[model samples]
Target: METKVIINEERCKSCSLCVSVCPKNVLRISNRLNPKGYHPAELFNNDECISCGFCYLICPDAAIVEVRRPIKVKS
Candidate 1:
């Protein structure tokens, strides 16, 4: 299964906490700003995410949630 991190822009504070803890460099600061007018965390390349949960674990804002892609099975 593939994994992806979904960021809640409303809750993020552009703290870059996730950017520091992410070993694979999955997260980055985007030019896009949230409603709060802060540039929050974003995915550089979501397909590379290993679901290490490092970002979620290190996030003080609880802004990131992980979603796993379902695998297909033969009938």
Candidate 2:
């Protein structure tokens, strides 16, 4: 299984809530500011993400979204 983290850069407030909640430590606050003048959260290393959706759940601004995709079986 694979998970994709989608962040709405403009909506992010750099609250760091998602970054702290993520168990896999996949998210981090970026140094660059977004159009909204906020340092949005970014995915640093998604390989460790378990599709836990903690980032999405913790984001108060609804900026984070997680998509889980099942890996195809090769028989």
Candidate 3:
């Protein structure tokens, strides 16, 4: 599955605000550290992501670069 939430690992500061605000718990702090020496946030469950943009809004550093929700089609 394609990731709806795109996070800039290098820009993340290990803040869990995005993780806390995520409704689906799709985002999590990665075990590996980034260039800045902080654990970056990563998309763990692409299928569960709802693309509500809560994570993006809560990220103070704007680590979440993009949020693309699937467009529903009318049947």
Each candidate's TM vs. the true structure?
Answer: 0.81, 0.84, 0.90
TM accuracy, model 3: 0.90
Q: Which regions of candidate 3 fall more than 4 Å away from where they truly are?
A: 73-75
Give the C-alpha lDDT of model 2.
0.82
Off by over 4 Å in 1: 1-3, 67-75
lDDT of 2 by residue, 8-71 (tens): 8889999999989888888899998999899999987767777778888888998885546457
Q: Per-residue lDDT tens digits of candidate 3, residues 1-75?
A: 678988889999998999998888888899999999999999999998888999989999989999998878799
Ranking by lDDT: 3, 1, 2
lDDT of model 1, residue 44? 78
Which predicted model would earn the best TM-score? 3
Computed on alpha carbons, the lDDT of every model, listed in order, comes to 0.83, 0.82, 0.90
Worst 10 residues of 1 by lDDT: 63-72
lDDT of 1 at 74: 90
